[model samples]
Target: MGEVDPAFVQELEHRPKQGIIEAEGLPIIDLSILSSSDATPDHSQALEGLVKQVGNACRDWGFFQVINHRVSMEKREKIFNASGKFFAQPLEEKNKIRRDEKRVLGYYDAEHTKNVRDCVKKLT
Candidate 1:
């Protein structure tokens, strides 16, 4: 988008870009093992490994993708469709629920990130 704000450009110039070079990719954690309730010894060990994977993913990346989470594709699609509709609204309409000092659980138009990019996100 047009040139980034000069202030943001300056900030980016001073920060290290090491994280990008160090990152492999977003971590992917399987939820299938955690969902089982089997009492076998192997199951317990597997569960522990799963937990460790989750902890590492959180501590290092702050987030991770989960597979075999058991949610139906239809339900996921519904959520995606709804989100699409919500974000597609005009800025004026979205601003009706804009987050402010008094509330921290609504739409945020421009969230600043360490990389000098603006991210639009909603919190609920």
Candidate 2:
């Protein structure tokens, strides 16, 4: 193919305007209840309560977080930092592990080749 034109590439990269909306929302539930020394009779009870709450949140709103879990503070902080760094990397670098290279693993943008049903089945 002939050499691509730089101006054409720049135009392709341009983004269109988006509408904005302001909305009020309720505060998230306080998770400190899971952390207190007197929170539950034992770890098993605490875990059971958390599982029920998480299941309800998943079914109702599709998202939740479990605070005061076994993951150490240092490990969680490290994971957060590492994820931020990975996301901040240049697109070229991230694309090295793009999803089509495997049935699983790496980045899969919305335009990924695999069908949604197949991907979900494989993931599950």
Against the correct fold, how does model 2 do in TM-score?
0.47
| C-alpha positional error of residue 70 in candidate 1 after TM-score superposition, expressed in Å | 0.7
Ten-residue stretch with the least lDDT total in model 2 = 115-124
lDDT of 2 by residue, 1-124 (tens): 9995443343322322232112322213335555666754686686677667767666544455455456787997798779778867998988888887445778655542222221221111
The Cα RMSD of model 1 versus the native structure comes to: 5.3
Give me the runs in candidate 2 sitting further than 4 Å from their true place. Answer: 1-50, 111-124
lDDT of each: 0.79, 0.55
Q: Please list all clashing residue pairs in model 1, or write none if there are none.
A: none
